[model samples]
Target: MRRGGAATRPSLARDTGLSKPTVGQALLDLEQDGLVRPAGRTSSGPGRTAVLYEADPAAGHVLGIDIGRGRLRLAVADLAGTVVAKVDEPNRCRSASALVRTVHDLATGVVAQAGMTLSDVVKTVVGSPGVPDRGGRMLHLAPNLPGWGRRGLLDELEAVLGPGLLVENDANLAAVGERDQGAARGVDVFVCVNVGTGIGMGIVVDGQLFRGAHGAAGEVGYLPYGWTDTDSEGWTPSTPGILEQAAAANSVVKLAKEHGVRNASSAREVFQLARQGDACARAVVEQEATKLAFLVASVSAVIDPELVLLVGGIGSNTDLLIDPLEKAVREISPLSPRIAPGELGEDAVLTGAIATALRAAQDIVFDRRGENLVTQRSGVNA
Candidate 1:
């Protein structure tokens, strides 16, 4: 009934392979529990009309929050996956504590706008820039947000948002968003390369997120750069990881400055100039695209994904980057993984978080069957 939107008793029985009496009894049980309710009647046959049943939207709601470096995005969805309210705001808070408070405020505000309170939300999923600690105590590898990876941060967030809250990596969530609603739909194997304030990859193999052995499978920032020159006269270890130093947003600005694009102050500006036919800015963009192409090629040589979804600020400019990027990748490697911009755009993380919450809340809203399947699938290896 939930998957098909609505079903009559006969249809339900036919789909479930259950006897008619058993289907009737199950529908009665679900209706009594307030999880499923009847919609308008439908006549599949010529004789009589049958009542259609669907998962009740009023039973519960799910909340999804995306905590980005510069912006905070949120959405509220009913149990049946309809978005009721949404909020997008600048992240003005400088400290992690302040950011947590902002999240609580925005979450409650959006739910209130949806004609509900925090009590009405059965599940909440927060997409932040880091690997979620399975112990549910801290977030790892989120260096852009100050104090984000401190010990006991998850405990602090849970205290503010109440129980039934799950924190997930934003990049991984973007990949999920693409898989569930964007370009990667029906794709069994793919990767999402997110280029925003930082660089990260989300690997989906066999239609599942592969977080590697230590919950860091997609942390491509640490990928080696120029390490083949083993006997270099001058090689220095830097704080910024290899991929980050060479390919992140800051690197775009640095490369533009090195190429004499004196007026450029940001990657957005550099891309804009390139689009306007500025030689220096175009060179900068090509350089950045070439480096990102190398990363794509490297990932292809390993996982050999069928498609790669580019996301975030850099990825949004697909019109300018795709041609040069594909050309460079073809020249560098024999592998030709199809690359394209993600459909969800900047809201991919929030959309994925909502999808995650909907999946988790659906289990609890209807019946507590066995274990928490969502948590089990996302924990440790999420």
Candidate 2:
């Protein structure tokens, strides 16, 4: 369907060894159902012509929300995966109702801007920075935002959006987003490690986001690798943890200060100094890269992903860490995954949420059509 929906139908039928008339009829039915529409005429050599059609962009709209540490981003996209309108706002306020209201208002504004209405929005997907259950209760503690772990967050969002709301962890969404539209576009097995305010990983197995039994499969932030604030022999999932304290922005700043570098406030500052060839800054970055490498190698030993996408606040910008990290990983593991930065940057989460929402919309259409077909078979709607 991506290759000029109408013109490719005959080709698809030929490739699949199906009858051209059957494919033509199916396409006609799809167009009548409002899922496909004539796009335009395709130009060709002398005397040859073909009309093109595509998936109807106006079939419906979907809303994607990415709840970041300091900001909330909401976007409305068409059926063809184009972002028609967007809204971004600071999320300093901690009320769940307020967040839902913000999403509702933003979605409404986006729809209006696109000359659509609330009814046009088929589904909504949210990417929050924690582990949320199917019931919408955030468990396993969000590192950046406080009070996000409480239950009913999904229900509140759904109550405002009406129906079809999906809540997913930010990193997991980022991983799928990258796989679908960014760096890992054609890869099947991969993992995306988001190294920003904290470290988190999104695992993709067989081209799908693989959330383990407890939905905490890629919780790299809690992966204890012999580093912790308190003296302990073994570190468990319930431990205080070390990734956030050792490699996060705040940790970078503190480590810089300990090395007599004063007033280094953020990770960007540290990276800038390192770029300028400051010995202390270079040393700090190298140390952090080593730790990150060890973490990745450990994950690879278990998941054995083909590629690893690096995303989030620090990971997106710190491509310099790759060379050193790769070398470090070679010492611990025989297999090294191809590591790359996410092409979509911070937008990965938003794009992924939109993809998820679009999938839900497609499911809705299929289910309703199936039910209608059943009714017709029974002479109920006939």
Residue 32 in candidate 2, Cα distance off native in Å = 7.2
How many collisions per candidate?
0, 0
Worst 10 residues of 1 by lDDT: 369-378
TM-score of candidate 2 versus the correct structure, residues matched by position: 0.83
Residue 147: error of model 1 in Å? 0.9
- Tens digits of per-residue lDDT for model 2, 150-184: 67766777777767677888889998789888999
| Best model per lDDT | 1
What are the TM-scores, per candidate, against the unseen true structure?
0.88, 0.83
Model 2: worst 10 consecutive residues (lDDT sum): 373-382
Kindly list the per-residue Cα lDDT of model 1 for residues 1-382, writing each as its tens digit: 5667888999877886767766776677677667779998998778889999987887788999999987899999987678999999999888999999999999889999999988888899998887888775898888778888888999889888879689988889999999999999999999999887888888999999999887888888768865566523343432446777788888899888888887888888999999999999988888878988889999999999999889988877888889899999999999989999999998899889989998988888765621233233235233
